[model samples]
Target: MQPHVTTALQAWIASWTAHERAAQDVMEAAFPGLKPTPAPTGCCDVQMRWERDGEGSGTACLDDHGRATIQFEDVPKAAVGHAMTEVFGNGWFNEGPDGFAGAPPGKYCWEDDCTYAECEIDIGDDGLAAVAISYVKIEDVVAILDALETGLEAVRPSA
Candidate 1:
């Protein structure tokens, strides 16, 4: 059953790419500076065992909640966090953009219900942020970003 769901998600994403250019255009229109990159890795397979990326790169699957977060070193968690929030749920951080609570700071925390979720990848004392390229609903991403664009606050990458 779960495998079928995963298969369906993959098929959906693949189909998305067929007309992805259009989606990209939409995403671009929403967040002009930000770009949606191809997912470097896909769903977990046999080779994707749960483990730490000792070299500062690794993937962690919070399967119980139907989500995963891949950590990266020196990747500017805040920048990514703000970008994701602005893109998905307005500029909601620490809490939601519109009174919607943001995901708490930590390694990614998949929600209990597993409906719409997010994860934070802590960048030291800064705060918890996301790990992956981030998987979010297309419409949500677009709506939130459109709002954020109106209130741009350029975040300089961590030095």
Candidate 2:
């Protein structure tokens, strides 16, 4: 990962140690070889990338003065879909009643006070999908990542 991205991700992760720790357990359970970078103080952002055997690859990033962004390139569509359903409840992503076959990508957004967050699912050319979450508030960032972590855990076996 680039230095700036690394710093950004560090900051973001550091800011959410409690949530990060819980997610770490989920991540470890799902992908044993994967390791997360420590979040030290003065870290300005959350930007890093990693890949592990038996697990997929992804990037987490944020600029010095912007919202946090995460992308899991090789994530299993089913796992992420299940996570989204669990996190946001039903009716969040409109894939029709039949499910993903002809469903377009899902998009959802919400705001609370001064913070805003957006979640999306991007389908790659390989027919696999990646989950991307961006948010401004620290809580939203944690919630998004936690949902992802929980979601990934939910689907780890099949993945």
TM-score of each: 0.37, 0.53
Poorest 10 consecutive residues by lDDT, candidate 1:
46-55
lDDT, candidate 1, equals 0.42
Among all candidates shown, the one with the greatest TM-score: 2
lDDT of 2 at 58: 74
Residue 135 lDDT in candidate 1: 47
Q: What's model 2's TM-score? A: 0.53
Task: Look at candidate 2 and tell me the lDDT of residue 93.
Answer: 56
lDDT of 2 by residue, 92-147 (tens): 55655533323455443333445556666765555457666765444445555566
In candidate 1, stretches whose alpha carbon ends up further than 4 angstroms from where it belongs are 1-18, 35-105, 108-116, 121-123, 126-134, 144-159
Question: Taking the tens digit of each residue's C-alpha lDDT, what string does model 1 give over 94-137?
Answer: 44343222444444333323545554445444442334433454
lDDT of each: 0.42, 0.56
